[model samples]
Target chain A: MVANIRDKAAIVGVANTAFSKDSGVSELSLAVQAIKGACDDAGIHPREIDGFATFTLDTNDEIEVARALGCGDLTFWGRSHYGGGAATGSLHQAVMAVATGMAECVAVFRALNGRSGHRYSQGVSGELLTADAIHWGWYTPYGLLTPASWTAMITQRWMHRTGVTKEAMFEVARCTREYAVSNPNAFFHGQPLDRDTYFNARMIADPLQLFDCCQESDGGSAIIVTTPQRARDLKQPVVTVKGVAQASAQGQEQMTSFYRDEISDVSEHRIAAGDCYEMSGLRPSDIDAAVIYDAFTPNVLLQLEAWDFCKFGEAGDFVLDGNLRPDGRLPTNTHGGQLSEAYIHGVNGLVEATRLVRGQSVNQPGKQVDHALVTSGVGIPTGGAILGKLD
Target chain B: MTPEEQKAFEDRIYAYVGVKVCERTAAKDAVNPAMIRHWAEAMGDTNPAYTDETWAANSRRGKTIAPPAMMYAWNQEGFTVTRGRASDPQTDMVELFNEYGFTGVLGTNVTQEYFKEVSPGDTLYLEMEIDSISERKATARGIGYFFETLATFSDQNGEKVGTQRFRVLKFIPQEQPTAATGDDKLEVPTRIPSPRGHDNGWWWQAVDEGKLLIQRCKRCQVLRHPPRPMCGECQSLEWDSIESGMEGEVISYTCLRHPAIPGYPKDPVCAVIKLAEGTNLVANIVGCDYDDVFIGMKLKGRIEQVDEKTTLPQFYPA
Candidate 1:
C-alpha cells in the first residue's frame, strides 16, 4: 500500500546568502544565518524547528545547528551521499520526517565555503588514504586528477556517437549567464558571458572548456519544510512538495563509470525522473520550469535527455532552438544555475524552485509556473523534486 | 661573440654533452603531519583531513596524507646545503654563463608526476639530472640558457614514488635583439624523460655518459623505452641494459601551442621516435623546421646537458 503523504509537507520559506568567491566567514555561521533567515521568512520562531537535513559532506553538524538556533530537542535528522545529487534527497528526508509526524518543522540546507576554503576545483589531492583513492591511484598517476578530466573521457565518446559540439555547452552557459545579470544574489550577475569570450576561455580539460565548468562559490541556502496545516497558518504562501525521488543504477561508481558496457548511460536519473512523475501524477509538459544541476554543462545536456525532456541526440538542437529561454515551452533555471549563479550544491536550485512556485523569482517568466521540477547532478545515486504552488 | 661564432661555440660545448655532473642527495627529515598543518595554516586551508582528527578517522581517506603539491618539500635542501658536494656542475655552468654575460635567471614551468601518496613517517630522496640546455635564445626577459632538470623521487624502500620536471631560464638582461637560429634548428629546450623510476634511472645515468641505453628483459627479451623494473610479458624484475647507436625514426608527432611550457618554443614539436631497437620513446623534435616535422622521418638520439646536475637523451632528424 502506498502510504502517500502527497502535499502534506510543504516548503513554507526559502532563503539564500550572497554567493561569491569568498564568504569571509565560517560555513557554520553561513548555515545558521541562512536557517535563521528562512525561519524569519516563514514567520516561525527558531525554537519550533525540530528537525534538520544537510549533505553528508557538509562541515556543519545538526546538533551544532540546533544549538545555534536554540531549537528544542530534535525529532529527526538525516543526510545523503553524492555532492549535488543529495540536494533533493535532503528535501525528501525533510518531507518524510514532516509527513510521518516525526517533526513539526524541518530545515533543509547546504552550506559551503567552496572557494574561500578548501576548493573542490583542485580535485583529489591526497585528502586521506581510502579505498576510493586506491582506485584513483591507477589513473591519477597519469595526470587525470580533476573532475573535468574524468568527464572528458565520457564527453569524447558521447561526441563521437551523437554530434554535440562545444557550442551546446556554451548555450547553457550563455542562457544562465544572461539570466544571472538580473539576479542580485547570483555571483555572475551583470557579467554575461558572450560567445567569443566563451570560446576564448582556456580549455582546462579537453571538450570541457573553462566556461563549461561551474563556479566554485561560498554561500548557504535553506528551505523551511513544515506540515501543510502549520504552513497555511503561517503568514507566507506554501509551496507544497508534490513528489520527489532518488535512484542509482547497477554499475554505479561515484563519478568515474567507464568500467560498464555503456559508459555514458545516465539511467539513474531516468529512474528518478520516472519516480517523480509517477509520484506527482504529472507529465513533463506539466513542469513549467526546471532547476537543473549543472556542475558541468555537458552533463546538463545529458540529464535533459535522461529525463526525457528531449530525444537522445536532440538535446543540442533543443538548447539551440531557444527552448531554455524565459518564454520557451519550459523556461529553465531562471535564477541561473551552478554554471552562473553559485554552486550551493542543489539547494540553490531548490531555493529557485520555491521562488518559481511562489512567483517571486528575480527572473520570473511570463508564463505561470504552477509546478517546478528541480534536479540534482546527473551521476548515479541522484535525486529530484517536483514542487507545486498551493492555490 | 657574433651570433654565428656563438652558435659554433655552443656546438663545441655540445660535444662535452654526456656529463654526470651532480651526485644523488637526500632530504634532512621525513614527512610529517606537522608539516602539513604548517602548510595548511600558511595557506589558510582548514581542510579537516589535514588538521582535525575525528573527521579523518571517519573519512574515506583512512589517515592523513601529505598534500600532493608538497612533493618538493619532502627533500628540500636548505638555503645552504650542509652536505654540499664540491665541484658542483650547476655552479660551474652558472660561472660559465656569467662569463658569457648571460646573468639573468628565472624559473619557468614545473610538471610533476605523482605515482603514490606520501604519508607521515615516509622518507623520500631525490636524484636530479640536467635534462637539456638550449642554444642562445633571446626573450623579452633576457637571453639565457633554459635549464630543464628532472628529479626522480623514491621512498626509503627504494620504490619510485614520483618525478618532477622543473625548467629554469638563466639568461642575460639584454636590450638589443639577437638574430634567430638556422631554419632546421629545433627550438632549444630542456629535455627530460617523461617517466624514469629506479629501474630505469641507470639508463638515464648511461645517457648522461653519452650512451643511448635500452632496457631488455632477460626473461622475455622485450625492449622498452622506459626501462621498468619488470618485464610486461614475463613479470621478471631482472633486465639487461645495452647502448643503442642513437638512431631512430619519428613515428608520430604533435605541435603544442597553449598551456605554454616556458623556456620551450611557444609552438613546440613533440615527437615519438621508434628506435632501431624496436622500442618507442618521446623526445623533442629539434634541429628541424616546424612545418617539416613528419612521421617516419629518420632520426638520431644524442645526449644534451639539461642543467648543471642532469643530462637528457634528445633526438634530431638524421
Candidate 2:
C-alpha cells in the first residue's frame, strides 16, 4: 500500500560542515560537528536522537559518533553499502525507525576527508590480487581495472545501444556545474564549467573526462528525521518523508557485472525508481526538484532516464533543454551535487533535498518546491527517497 | 623406513647440502605497461596488444592490454642465505647420493583476480612478506632428506598475488655407510662435474655480485635465453645484461613445472621473475630454493664475472 506523502515522518533539521578540499579535521570530528549542528538546528537535545544511519564506507563508527555527540541511547543504528548509493538508504532507515516508533527522532549523516585523507583515484595494486580480485584477473591482465575504466566499459556500450552522444553526457555536467555556481557550499561555487571545457577536459577513461567525474571533497552533513508532530515543534519547517525504496538486481557484483545480458540497462535502478514513484503516488511531473546522485556525470543522465523523467536515451536531450535548471522544469542539486558539492557519499544530497522543500536552497527554484526526489549510488544495490512539504 | 633410520639418513644428507637466505628491497615505480609488455614478450607470448599501442587502440579489445599472467614475469628483490651456499663438492655429491634423501617440493597455483586492466603507463609499488616456513622428512630415489620452505607473496598495497612451496633433496654418497636395509643393497655413483652453465654458476655469480641479470636481445631490445635462445620478442639473438638493483617485487610466481619439459624433475620449481628494471627473467631459482619463494619476495643480484671474458649474474634472497 502507498503511504501519504504529506503525513509521513518529517525532517526536523539539516546541518553540514563547510565543504572544502581539506577540512584539516578528522572524519570523527566532522561527524560529531554535523550531528551537534543538526541537533542544535532542530532545537532538540542530542540525547533525544535514538536512531542513526550512516554509510558503510564512513570511517566514523556509530559508537564513536554517539559517544562524541553524547547520544544517551541508540535504539537503532545501521549502515548502507554501495558508496554513493547509501545516501537515500540512510534516510530510508531513519524514516523506517520513526514510522515504526522505534525512535522519536533519527540522525543520519556521512562524513569524510575523501580528497586529502584517502584518495580512490589511484589505480589498483597487488593487494587486489586476492581470491575475490581474481575475477578481474581475466580482464585486468589486459589493462581494464580502475573504477572509471570499469564504468567506461558500460558507458560505451550504453551509448552504442542508445545512440546517446557525448554532448548529451555533457549536459548533465553543465547543469550540475550551473547549480554549483550559485551554491556557496558547493566546491565549484562561482566557477561553472562550460561545454567546451567539459569536452576539452582530460579523459580518465574513454568516455569519462575529469570534469565528467564527481568531485572529491572533505566535509560532513547530517539530517534530523522525526514524526510530523515532533517536526512541527522543531525550529525548521517540516519536510515529510514521502516515499523510499532500495533494490538490487539479479546479476549484481561489486564492479564487474559484465556478465549481465545488457550493459546499457540498469534495471535495478529503474526498479527502485518505480517503487519510489509508486509509493509516493507522485508522477515524475510532480517532483519540484531533485538531488540525483552524480557520482559520475553519465550516471546522472542515466538515472534521469531510469526514473522516467524522460524516455531512455532521451535524458541527454532533456538535460540539453535546461529542463533541470532552477528556472527551468525541475531544479536539481541546488546545493550542487557530488560533482560540485562535497561528496559525503550522497548524504549531503539528502540534506540538499530537505533544504529544497524548506525553501532554504541558495539556488531555490522560482516555484514553491513542494516535492523533491533523491537517489543513492547506481550500478549496485542502491536506494532512493521522495520528500514532500508537510501539510 | 623406520622413523629412527629416516632421521639418521636425513642427518647424513644435511652434512652435504647447504642453505642461503635472501634480503628484501622496496619496489616503487615497478608497474608500467611498456615494462610489463617487455616482460610478457620475453615469456614467448605473441599478443600484439601488449606492445603496439596503435594496434591495441584499433583492436576490438580497446586499448593495449597486459596478459594476466605477465605480473609474474619479473624477478623478486631480496636475499638471505638460508642453506647450502657453502657446501663443498664432496658434501654436495653426498647430498645427491642417497635416493631416500630427496624431499620433493611442489608449487601449486592458488587463485588470481584482476580488477583494473594493467597498461604500460601505470606505476606499481610492491612489498613482500614471508608468511611461513616448515620442514618435513622424505625419501627420494631410496635416499632420505630433510624439510623445505613455503613463502607467500604480497604486493606493495598489501595484496597477495602468489605463493611457493618448496623442498630439497639430500643423499649420502656411496662412501658413506648407510644403515643396513633387509635385502636392499644400494650402489652410489662417483661424482661427475656438472656442465658449466648447467650447474647454475651464472645465477650464483649474480647473487655474489649484488646484481640481477637477464639475457636480453641486443639487436631488438628484447629479453630471452633463460631456458633457450629463441627470442620471444623479435626472435633475434640472445644478448644479455646484468640487471641493476635488487628493487623489484614479485608480481606473480609459480612453484611447479608444466608437463611439457622432458626429463623435468618430478617436482621442479620455477618462477617468472619480474626484475626491478622492468624486465621479466625466468629461471630455476637456487640457494634457498624452498617453497617459500612467494609472489612478493624481494631478491637481490649476485654477479660472477666468469673467465675474464664473460660475466654472469644470478639472484638470491635479498
Candidate 3:
C-alpha cells in the first residue's frame, strides 16, 4: 500500500538566508543559521530539533549542524543523492522520520556556496567518486561536460520531435523573472528580462541561453517538519504534506542518460508525479500553483509535461498561453524560481511552496492556492511533493 | 579574419544546406548470402535468421534476410571514398572549410532510425542531403565549424528502410607539446580515461591489442557489452570474449559544445554504435567530416593511440 502520509506531517516553518553571489562564509555556517532560523519561526528552541536531513552534496554534516544548533541527542539522520533531484526526497525522509515517530522534529535543509566556493555551472572535472562517472567517461572526453550541455542534448531531441522553439523557452524565463521583480530576496528582483535581451544572451548550449539557466548564488534554505498534532502548537500556519515520493526510473544515469529509448522523456518525473498524485488522491487539476525545477528553462517545460499539467508537447503552448503568470491559470515560481531567485538547490522551492499554501507569497496569486506542487531536478533520479493548507 | 571574410565564408557554407550529395547511388551488388555469412561469422552472431535458411524460411520472415545494419555496407564506395568523390556536396563543404585555416576534420556523431528490414535478393539505393551547418565557434578542438547531413536508404520497390543523421567538425588543431618527456605530463589534462576495474580490465586490454571484444555468457550464449562478471540473462560467472566485427552503424549521437573540456577537441561529436556483433559500444568517430557521419552509416573501428598513455577504440567511415 502507498504510504498514507497525507496530512500526517506539516511544515510549520520555512526560512532562507539572503541570496547572493558570495556568502563570505563556510557552507556549515549557512546551514546552522538557516536551521536555527527555521526553528525560531516554528516557536521551537534550537535544542528541540532532534533530526536532520539533507542532500549528499551538502558540505554540512548532520552532527556538525546538530552541534552548532545545540540540538539534543539526534535520533534520525538522512541524506539523499543526485543534487537538486534530492530536494523533495530530503523532505520525504524528514516526513517519514516524524510520521513514524523515529524523531519528533526534523529539519530538512540545504546550504551551498555555489558561486563563491564550488560553482556547479562550470562543469564537471577532476576525479569523481560516484559510479555515474563511469558512464560519463563516454561523453566527458567529447566535451559534453556541463549540466547545460547534458540538458541541451536531451532538450534538443525533445524540441526536434515536438517543434518547440526558443520563443517558448523565453516565456518561462520572462514569466519567472516577472515574479522575481516583487520578491526582494530574489537575485533578479527589480530587474526584468525582455525578449530581445533573452534572445541576444550568449548561448550556454544551443536552445539554452544565459537567461534560460538558473542563478548560481550562495545561500541556504531550511524547512521544519513534524507530525500535525505537534505542529498545531507551532507559530506559523500549518502547511501539510499531502503527497511526497522519490523515483529512479529504469535506465537512469545521472544527467547523461542518452542510451535510453527516448532521451527527451523525463520518466522519473512522470513516475514520481503519478505516485505523489496516487498517494494524495489529488490530480493535476487540483494544483493551484507549482514551482517545477528550472535548472534550465527546457526542464521547466519537460516537468510541466511530465506532471500532466498539460499534455505532452503542450507545455510550450501552455506557457505561451500565460498560464505561469501570477494572475493566470496556475501561477508558478512566484518567488522567481531558480531562474531569478537564488539556487539553494530545491529547499528554497519548498519554502516557496509553503508560502503559497499560507497565502504569504510575495507574488501571491489572486486565486486561493488549495495545493501547490513542487518538484526537484530532471534528467536524473528525481522526486516531487505536494503541499496544502490543513482542512 | 576580417568580418567581411567571415560573412562570405558563412554564406558560402550555409548555402550547402538542402543540397543533395547523391541522388540515387545503387549498391554494387544485390543483397546475397555470402556477405551476410561473412558478417555473421565476423560478428559471432548466431541468430539463425541471417544464416539458417531453413530455419528462417519456416519462421515469420518466410526466407533468409540481411541484418538491417547491413544497409550501409551494401552501398559503401570502399577505396574510392579516400580520394574524395567529384560533385559531392560533403566533399565540397570540407574543401571549403579546409580552404580556410580549419583543416582538421573529425566525424562526431551518427543516428539511424530504422523503419523496415531488408532481405537477401533486395537491391538498395542511397541518397544524401546536406542537412545543416553550424557557425564558426571556439571549441576545445580549437576554432571550428560543424556540419550535418541526412542519409536515406530505400529498397528496390521504393520503400524507405532507414534514415541517418551524421555530424562532423572541421577545425584548426590546437598546438601542444608532442614530446612525451616531462613528469608534469602525467598531471597535464588528457582524455578522461575509461574506468577499467576488475570486471572489465580484460576488455580494455583487448582494445589495446586492436580488438573490440564482447562478453559472451558460456551457458546462455547471450552477448553483452561493457563487460561484467555475471550475465543478466542467466546467473552465471562463466563467460568468454568474442572479437567483434567492429563494423557497425551509428544508432544515436550528439555534438557537445559548451564549457569546453580539456584534452578534447572542440565540440566532440559522440555516438553509440550498434556493432555488427549485435552489441552496442560507445566510441568516438574520427577521420571523416562530422556531417558526413549519420545513423546507419557503416563504420570500422581501430584501436588508436589518442594520447601518450591511452589507446581507445575509434571509428571511421567504412
TM-scores, one per candidate: 0.60, 0.56, 0.71
In model 1, the number of clashes is: 13
Fnat of candidates, each listed: 0.00, 0.00, 0.30
> How does the DockQ of candidate 3 come out?
0.19
lDDT for position B113 in model 2: 38
Greater-lDDT candidate between 1 and 2: 1
lDDT of 2 by residue, A1-391 (tens): 5453435688888899998888998999999899888888889998898989887788998988888888888889888876676888888888888888888888999999988887555334224633344344323322344556556656766776677888877777787888888877788989978877888887676567888788778989999989998788778988898889888876665554553545457777888888888988889999989998888877887888898899987887888888878787878777778888777788888888988988888888889889999998777778789899876
lDDT for each residue of candidate 1 in B1-318, tens digit (9 for 90 to 100)? 896978875775454344444555666888888888888888888888777767778889777777777788877766666777455566676667777777777677776778877777888888877777765555656766676677788888888888887777777775543454345332333322223445555765676688887888888887764555777679988889777887987654544432343433334455546778777655566667656865568998788764434465667788
Cα miss at B11, model 2 (Å)?
Answer: 64
Candidate 1 deviant stretches above 4 angstroms:
A1-3, A129-131, B1-165, B168-318
Q: Top lDDT: which candidate number?
A: 3
Global lDDT of each model?
Answer: 0.77, 0.66, 0.85
lDDT of 1 by residue, A19-99 (tens): 889899999999999999899889988899999998888889999999988999999999987777799989989999999
lDDT of 2 at A195: 73
Instruction: Compute the lDDT for candidate 1.
Output: 0.77
